[model samples]
Structure formats: C-alpha cells, structure tokens
Target: MSGSKKTYDTDTVVFGAGTAVIAAAIAAAKEGQETYLIEINNQIGGVMAASPGMMLGAGYPMKTSIGGFFKDYVQRMYNHTPPLARRRLSTLENLGEEVVYDPDYAIFL
Candidate 1:
C-alpha cells in the first residue's frame, strides 16, 4: 500500500456489511474511486448468512447479451451450481406452500 497518495476522510465510506455494503465497494472500485466498506462482523455477507440461496426477485430473468457486474455474479451462480444441486422440495413445513429445489437448504445445517 502506498502512503504517498492515500488520505484520511475518504470520498466514500460505507459502514455495516451485507449485500449493500459489498455492492457499494464493487461500485466504488469499478468507478476507480477510493472506497471502504466496513463490516462489524468478520465475514462480508450479513443477512445472507441466515438466508442463503439466490434472491428470486423478478423471477427467472430474461437473458441479456450485454453483461455487467451483477449479471456476471448471477451467471457465475448459475454456471457453477451443478444440475444435481437443483432439486425440488416440499414447502409445507415452513414456507406454508409448495416449493422446489435440489434439497432443503437446511439440510446442510
């Protein structure tokens, strides 16, 4: 780390960790700005620690030709996750409805 160019009281400093803070760091780093994302916890993801699995918001997304950071992230998930990992499950236990998946996420725990 070079101390010559560095300065205190940064242009951007996001406290608390989670997807939001991580996103902020990515945005700042992509923008070529000096940024710092602080997390009280030792790990990066906060709520995601409790709630695993991809966010199903907007449903199965329509594929796009042009890719960005977020798109690339999702693409990595889709590609890296094996087909065998995709299993359906009964949701009557907790979700109060039918659900599908490779296995109940709780199985790991």
Candidate 2:
C-alpha cells in the first residue's frame, strides 16, 4: 500500500443508507448542501431492503399524524402509478399504523 491518502469533502455525509439516513441525505440536498450516503451493501434501505415484504410502522403507539420527510416519503409511495404503498393497522395491537409497501418500488423511489 502507498502512503497516499484520498479525501473527499461534502456538506453532509450520512452513514448507512437506511430509510432515515436516505431521508436525511435528501433533506440536506434539498437545502443546497452537498450530501453523500454510504452503505455497506450494494443497495440501500437497510433492514427494509434486507427483509423483503417488510412494512414500516408509522405513528407507532401515539398514532399521531406524522409530517416532514416521512410523510412525504409515504405520499410518494401512494402517488406512484400503481400505488407502491398503503396505510394499514399493524397486526400487533400496540404497533399503531404501518405503511405496507413493495420493496422493489420503495428502493427505486
């Protein structure tokens, strides 16, 4: 190995490409910041992508309305051509609301 080193500069560097981190990166980019997302796997979405057919729980326990990136993300899913996601109650009682979505569609979105 050579003694040379490479460094990159970015306004925002989000570790892991999970749903939350992806959202954070998008938010930063929208704010005109240079953002970078790093993920170990070839794909993003973390556990969501790793486990196919997984549903995202929103407004858990509180069941309150959620806004910001999460809300927008869900809206995008619903607004897709065939509707990539749907709002539903969790099978487990205390889990509150969930967003059931197609993994493939979610990744591309």
Candidate 3:
C-alpha cells in the first residue's frame, strides 16, 4: 500500500462486510463520516454461511432480542429459499420450522 496515494479526502475506510464490519460501517456512515466497506472475498455473508443456522444470537443489537440487519438478512434468505422436503434436514431447519424443501433452495440460496 502506498501512503502517498490517498483514496479520499474524508476520514474513514472500513474493512470487510462481516457482522462486526457491517455494524461499524453502518455506525460510521450514520454518523455522517465518510465510510467505505471493502470486502476481501466475492461473498459478503461471512461466518453466517459456515454456520448454516442464522441466529440473531445473544448480545445482538435490537429492541427485541434479535439483531437488526442480521435478522432482516436471514429472513430474506428464508423468503427466497423453498421450504425443505420431509420437514427434516441434515441439520435443523434453517427457518426453525417444518416446511417443504425448495429443490434449488441452497444452490441458489
């Protein structure tokens, strides 16, 4: 990296789109500061993909116990994917409910 070539006149550049990274990006951007998110990989979902189960988890940011953007993101995932078949999965239902399988679900999901 060359210190000589400055990217922007404003002050902050966020790295990655991980949960923590997105939080920081949203916070910084909300504050009116110049913020940028740089993702290393083509994929942006981070650790969520590996875990399979999308949980708001403990200590997430939300008025209710669930987190904000994270919850919305997961819901969008379920909304798009078809319900699983047999009402059972190799793992627990990602949606945490019994539903038919969407054949192309995970592939496109």
Candidate 4:
C-alpha cells in the first residue's frame, strides 16, 4: 500500500500542532533549528480549536505569569486590535490567574 518514503531534512520534527507542540516548534525554530510540525488535523491548534470556552491557566498556583513563549502569546492576545483575551481570577479557590479568550479570535491569532 505504501510507495516511496519521504524524508525531511529538519533539526527538529515535532508531532502534533497543539498549543505546547506549537510552542516547542517555535522555540526550536527560534534557536536557528530547522523545525517541522506535523499535525493530524487540518487546523494548527489541537484541543484549543476543538474545545470552546477553553481557559488557559498561565499563572496558576504560583500567581505569576510564566514567561517565554506563553507570555508572548498572552501579550499578543492582549495587544490584538479587539483584545482577544482577558485575565480572570480562577473560579476555584487558590487557583490563581487564568486567561479567557474568544475561541474564534484565538484560532485566528
């Protein structure tokens, strides 16, 4: 059933295009590595695209923003023309900060 095997010359090959996977790909690319991302779905985001009203708990129990790619992503959402996201206190006690964003806008971003 299979024919020729295609090979990719990449320093990093990340399977899946989930939030974490995307971040890893981006980080690898940023480090001057030739990174490739493979996703089963047509879209980039995995659970993020599937689940509506999904909240990203960036600054959870520690109550501090986790810097790096996540921080940049949050900043981008905040800086969007229409402001795609907003910080909120988690409903659960001591859960710390969470980001609630428009799923459509999130996908676009």
Q: How high is each candidate's TM-score?
A: 0.52, 0.80, 0.48, 0.83
Model-by-model lDDT, in order? 0.49, 0.77, 0.51, 0.77
Deviating ranges (above 4 Å) for candidate 1: 1-9, 58-69, 81-109
lDDT of 4 by residue, 1-109 (tens): 6998988777999999988899999999999999988898778777776664434554355667558987898789889988888887777766566777876678677
Q: 1-109, model 3: which lDDT tens digit per residue?
A: 7568655666678887666687687778878988878888876645643444433333334313344654444455556534323323324333333323333343233
TM-score of 1: 0.52
lDDT of 4 at 45: 77
Model 2 TM-score, all chains together:
0.80
* Tens-digit lDDT track of model 2 for 2-104: 9999899889998999988998999999999999888887888876665544335544555644578877877898899889888887787666667787787
lDDT of 1 at 50: 51
Score candidate 3 by TM-score against the native.
0.48
Q: Candidate 1 — worst ten consecutive residues by lDDT sum?
A: 95-104
Error of 3 at 27 (Å): 2.2
Where does the lowest 10-residue lDDT sum fall in candidate 3? 84-93
lDDT: worst 10-residue window of model 4: 52-61
